[model samples]
Target: LACAFMVMSGYCELTSVSSFDAGSFSSKIVTLESIQIFTTHEWLPAKPTLYFLCQGGNRTGLPDVKKVDFLYTFNGDESWQPLTELPERKCKRCGLYEEDQIKSDDVFDEWELCPGDFVDGKYVHFKEKEFNATFACPLCKPLEEGSPSSASKNEATAHGMNVALVIVISALVSIVVISGAAVGYKYWQKKKREQEQARFLKLFEDGDDIEDELSLGNTL
Candidate 1:
């Protein structure tokens, strides 16, 4: 079967190849426009991690995709929601990761899960795993899953730190700018005063010469 799939970033034509047997039947994706797909199946509460790979006949873990004429939702939800992207851990869920779907504008962002994947700084590089664990919430996985209240607090604290740092730096910068402007203004005033004094002295000397000439003329 051949169909078009609208993913988060764009649209692609997806073809499925099915092989039938007496006991088992399997379907394989024969063609897709892009080499990779992103999925949030890993971070789902208790389910086993099915990251990025779209499997099953129903395409069960996929999200809602909309085209001009039709709309499709994964798992029958009115809207498709991609969970935060996470990598498959060794079942301990210690080092789960979340990656955003790549945007055309964000080409350079990268999280190199495999060796030899050379992603530059423009690609989003996943930071060190922010520790997640189930606390008060029963819906949370055995390890860290979902944005719990505690996680929210942690994010808020980090944000607060960032804001305070920016404020302090801004204040320091304002002080430096004001001080420099004052120094420049004072220097300009001093130079102007010196120039006026020199002009006055020249005028006074010229007047003295004129008086001397007049006195000499009178004496003659």
Candidate 2:
């Protein structure tokens, strides 16, 4: 009877983090997509209320769920609420529980919830005596070591290349401007020298003409 119950209840063994590939985990938003309870672990005429507990008794209730052995599906609406936010690089001690009027809450199952547990954006947690559940975290991902630092290094290298290109362009522009200024100055000096030589020759020719005129006057 126990074996038959375990089989019918979809029993799942506890999985460890070491079973997954080695990588750093990232934060993700978890959603309780669907759940079905095979046994409520309650007596007759029991009013079972489901809630999630994590981070040392922080409770979040699913007020709408009350039935057992019926698959409850959540639509993409207000009824489909986010369960919890898992931290990056840390596994949360979490579990599902039922509220009890006579005593402490009844635990369905307790496990260390890690981002790596989700395969292809979903994870199924099942306990033989309690319940079977499906959780969704579409954005959960495992990051390799040095990934963020590698991105920062790439950005820094690109910035350095941009600065070096700007410096080279500025140096080229300065060289062109200085060469043009030097050429213009040399041209102006050549023109001034030519003008001065022409003026001196004109002065010498005027003196020669005056001397020739004085000589003719003396002869006459």
Candidate 3:
């Protein structure tokens, strides 16, 4: 018995506008830029628990801002977490903040995401004065040395595999088609031979009957 495997696909995405220069307050604000969406299928056999690991930063190394706040929203859920865990290591100089100055404490304490706020579907949207972003787990790919780069490579590899799979599928289909044509040709040849044999037998019987008729007439 052959055991079949089902393809259970899933993915997460992150979107942000171009990086903002938060200056010395870089750690205080994530350069708000673009928003992203995440989607995935939930298999019946194994349901996975989802977790969010979020991060932010400023591109400039200038003196960080005095204080910054961060806001977040999630799909189908009202109100966002004031503060979420950073995706990367914490900077020793900034304490709770990641390098570039986006501090975890300021966001949770100062940010306000009152009513009628939602991130929209399997995604966590981070919004701030200078920083706006969104994240999801399943759709998140890994970066070359980190989650971001690895994620991109994974997508490229998956695409290549899909292309190879299509080629293999086409080859198998061609083989099946060729085999069917050969079988049909053999069947046609067998039927033609049978018809020829029948025709020859009918002619032989007619000739015998004619000879019998001649003999009878002569005797008469």
| Candidate 2 per-residue C-alpha lDDT over 65-118 given as tens digits, one digit per residue, 9 for 90 to 100 | 788788887752445367788876566899998888888878888997867667
lDDT tens string, model 1, 1-220?
Answer: 1322345223322222222341122211111111122322233243222212221212212222211123222321223222222222211111222333442111112222211111221112232222111111111223243435336546867999999999999999999999999999999999999999999999999999999999999999
TM-score of 3: 0.34
Ranking by TM-score: 2, 3, 1
Q: Which residue runs does candidate 3 get wrong by more than 4 Å?
A: 1-146
* Number of the predicted model whose TM-score against the real structure is largest: 2
**Candidate 3 lDDT, 21-65, residue by residue in tens:** 333223321221223213212323332222222334222211222
What local distance difference test score does each model get?
0.36, 0.78, 0.39
**Comparison by lDDT, 1 against 3, better one:** 3
* Residue 77 local lDDT, model 3: 27
Question: Can you tell me which runs of candidate 1 are displaced by over 4 Å?
Answer: 1-147
Per candidate, the number of residue pairs that clash is: 11, 0, 37
CA RMSD of each candidate after superposition: 19.0, 22.0, 22.9
What TM-score would every model get versus the actual structure? 0.33, 0.50, 0.34
Model 2 scores a TM of: 0.50
Query: Least accurate stretch of 10 residues (summed lDDT) in model 3?
Result: 7-16
